[model samples]
Target chain A: MTAGAGADAGVVVGVDIGGTKVLAGVVDAGGRVTSTARRTTPGRRVVASQVEDALVEAILESAGGRHLAGVGVAAAGFVDSAGERVMFAPHLPWQGEPLRDLLEDRLGCPVLLDNDANCAARAEAHHGAARGAASALMITMGTGIGGAVLLDGHVLRGANGMAGEFGHMQVVPGGRSCECGRSGCWEQYSSGNALVRDARALMADQPSVLTDMSDGHPDRVTGPMVTTAAEAGDLVARAAFASVGDWLGVGTANLVAALDPEVVVIGGVSAAGDRLLDPARTSLQRTLVGVGHRAVPRLVAAELGPEAGMVGAALLVGGDGTRTAAP
Target chain B: MTAGAGADAGVVVGVDIGGTKVLAGVVDAGGRVTSTARRTTPGRRVVASQVEDALVEAILESAGGRHLAGVGVAAAGFVDSAGERVMFAPHLPWQGEPLRDLLEDRLGCPVLLDNDANCAARAEAHHGAARGAASALMITMGTGIGGAVLLDGHVLRGANGMAGEFGHMQVVPGGRSCECGRSGCWEQYSSGNALVRDARALMADQPSVLTDMSDGHPDRVTGPMVTTAAEAGDLVARAAFASVGDWLGVGTANLVAALDPEVVVIGGVSAAGDRLLDPARTSLQRTLVGVGHRAVPRLVAAELGPEAGMVGAALLVGGDGTRTAAP
Candidate 1:
């Protein structure tokens, strides 16, 4: 089936469930979000029912009496190959949860669940920076690095649908410890969290505008604050960005060596446009194997922003023709 | 067309061109080598015509007057996407030479050219360790690391045929100098060359059987000698194998994080069974991302051994229905 199908008679509901927020939208076949709704995600300590309640509310508000063809949930977790269950979600209350069936039952429509990064990659391949490319690598650098690979216009969801976890590839031996019980993961040096961590360390040692922005509490410095400070010409903030971008390039080089995609699209909060991509481009060229002899894949910023995940989810449900069976 | 076709009527010749040796074989549709021939690769300083002559001689000897359907050349170099010219071969005297057309003219049959690693990976997917796997990553650890990826049985050749140069991926920040003009490439720590390098370094500092095996010259220690010594319970030799295997595992972990294949097939000389893979297995588990939560791809040794490249090349020509057009 063609991608982003159902452009004429039907609309799909796309819900993006993150750790702190849930964003839902009614997307038509053309990838247009006609209606949107947002809700604060309940804390992880809350019951699974509470989280489900938040998702249901967001979908209901977004649907707003529209005839829905299918519903897609872009979740921040490990989605199973069948798109029926969430095996684990670090920040959400999901462990072997049948999220797809529950949503289908509640909404009375077909539902498909997928990792947010995969959804975003599909979105980019269908309508954004990676459009028309034979293959692409999409990296969403938020709190940590999340990745998705599109090969021949299909998401390469490994054997267990857990492929493209590029962040955890160890770059340094016995270096920075990670929550996944590993050290020197690419994310430790290149993600949004890495940017803030480096910025805070720089703040501790040097005088910078970040100290004032964080109100003298370096611990309170978030990723966005550092980006803001860097844009204002803060040396420490810019240095942190440079460090992260360098590591991003190193990791991209490793990916290119392995996958050899036609283009690499950087998304999520760290897409900081030229701030992150310029240094990444330089480092990627410097570190890439056979740089002088080989054709270097284009490195570009993602065209779609945060809304990419929701739109991609909607498209996947509408296009792949995999709808929930009737209750 | 199905892979390894033409089992009933015509046979194909597969030729593997390496730095030191050229191996050619007559392969039937069942992936069996009926007749084989070998020759010394002319030194790189020799003219390109001499190298081509050596390959043609091997093919003629292997064909033995049998009706040939096609001939496939698996060269150790950067082959372009069209499989007609060799962009650059490190150890061969070829630069943008139209090897395919030249071979077809001499052989009076169809000809196809491809990277040696891609040929080997294709062989495994069709007839060996990676058979039946939905996706597989093949790592050939000879003097250096060569890699190939197969998805749904087709080799992922990337935009250019230069996608599988896994040896050049920098694993260390500034560790060992590589022939590719890079530092700390995976090959520096993990290939057959790495094993010999480590053995020599150990022989320099410590008393070991390798010194005696090399006739008191540490520089003369070869990869096979070290492997044989390690099999004989030599500590230094075992340590070298362990070191190479650990790096192999680390590189495998990086590949898994990006590709997430169902199985990883280790081929080439270093597929010395458990000597390399046992240590690789331990390190792969230790370095793999989401170790406990995600399914660990089974790691297995290649089934076809050194003959895989030749066999795969024959299969590529016999299958895919792409042959040199009759002039």
Candidate 2:
């Protein structure tokens, strides 16, 4: 924690507002957290005001005797260039909600907002995983796929302030129906949801050990359960993981062909260590276009773990807000 | 000419060395041509040393009495980072050729080399169709498809300096074989060759206006003939343009979904004054992934015409080897 005092004592508060949980931390200039707090996200029907109030409360609790420099909130949705409003968030009840303005008013400080994946990318670029790289692409595979791009030591926000929507890129024409009302999106094949769906489908077809592995409770077939079963040499779970890995490789290959970044850092629940990446690496080489001609961007697991968004949020306050700063 | 003289007064020569022709011009600092020279390309069987000598002669002849600043050559294939070598050009017999050193020695001036497409994109960004834009994707649809990406006013050269090889991006798996040993690339559907192939294929099977349009010479079908027939309202030729336009839209949509540039400039023989671009514009929206959600990047024909690459080459010299020196 002593290292935190050397960088900049802006006393930044990092908040990761995810679908499953709301994690907040008070970070010093050197990226050390002095106080932390977490809470389950409000229910599906919760209003924007309620979520805003909860976010403000969490910030105050985490602040604990520290003066605030600025606040960074990582929300799961499309954030516009201004970083004050949420354009869209399917999992959250924030449609065109001025989350940044609301938070700033409540906390008495400047606020910056960005997509969760972009937040994770910034964190990796600032402190872990993709640190010191000129360019990198961060992919977070959980219930769904999420992505962020860092170009020339900064994030690439496209013309409309919307880039790195890589999860929505078509991986298959008619593979699976995504909640976005599109089929064959990268997320549907290479995500935690994809793993669970494959596991359930496999269990239904052949009476595999995974069905018995889950003890006949088909509904209990989770991503981690499938991973554990695969590690234990279960055929169905292994197949499911392999399927996810294959799709991961396909998506990564498309990404490499398009962006040509120096490195790709994989995170999220599906990446849980190396099970997903091993197959992904094998498939990446196989599916990669112009294999031997171009330099293959390195694929590595994210080193910052799940708390990367929070750390990145804290780092944003200390780093250049040139583009990712509060408007 | 006065505008050219008003800028920096120092002239720089631009040489375009293609497989079929070698074109050189002395370009003033303001993009005005002072003098010009042209010659047919030398035999491909000879070593690059002979070819370099021929190009140097053309450049010196074009230079005439102009006090030169430098020379920028737009080679037909992949050019290295230093803009001094032709790394690989399948159509042209050049492999790891030190083009700049050879030319600088012969021409007695500093030399810059870059792929024709990159130079074309740079040209459009500086003084052509994409002028004043923050970013753009330039697609040159000639006998082959060539591409370049301009980001923040600089051509985006990837890790291996081979980033803008968009024509080689696989559009269809195992589809029409290419000379690059690939199948179903974007260029296969949208290039000049694609136009002729589709026109010939239509002439053979479907009984349509193409037979009468071609004046019974079915074997002599060409891109220009199709353009003329399309203007005359030939259904088959219109269909051919539509087909190419469809693929152009698909390829451009893929790019739009990835880069999200402010504009997409269509150049080369296919653009032949918006005959191709009219349908391309309509199809681009239809094929766009998030059609209704995002602002579509403007699709336009190159204003600098076929000389875009040559003009861009001159601008490189005018800028004195610093690519981003111009507006």
User: Model 1 lDDT vs. the true structure?
Assistant: 0.86
RMSD each, Å? 2.8, 3.5
lDDT of 1 by residue, A1-327 (tens): 222335444567888999989999987667788889999999688889899999999988897876566788899999987788999998898898999899888877778888999989988888888998888899988889998889766789888888889999888988899988989899999999999999999989999999998899999999889888999999999999999998999889988987778999998743377888889999999988878777899988888898999988886674544563210
Output the worst ten-in-a-row residue range by lDDT, candidate 1 chain B. B318-327
Model 2: colliding residue pairs: none
Candidate 2 chain B weakest ten by summed lDDT: B1-10
Weakest 10 consecutive residues of candidate 2 chain A by summed lDDT? A1-10
Runs of candidate 2 with Cα error greater than 4 angstroms are A1-10, A173-176, A200-207, A214-220, A269-273, A319-327, B1-9, B212-220, B269-275, B287-290, B318-327
* Model 2 C-alpha lDDT per residue in residues B1-327, reported as the tens digit of each score: 111233354467777888888888876655666688887777567787778877877887897866556777888877765566788776566888888887777766667778888878887887778887777888888887778878865777666667676776656645788776656667888889898888888878777666876787787788888888878887778788888887887677767766778899888843355767867888677655566666788998877765666767776653543333422
lDDT of each: 0.86, 0.74
* Model 2 Cα shift for residue B155 (angstroms): 0.8
Residue B2 miss distance in model 1 (angstroms) = 4.2
Chain B TM-score of model 1, please?
0.93
- What is the TM-score (0 to 1) of candidate 2? 0.90
Q: How accurate is candidate 2 locally (lDDT)?
A: 0.74
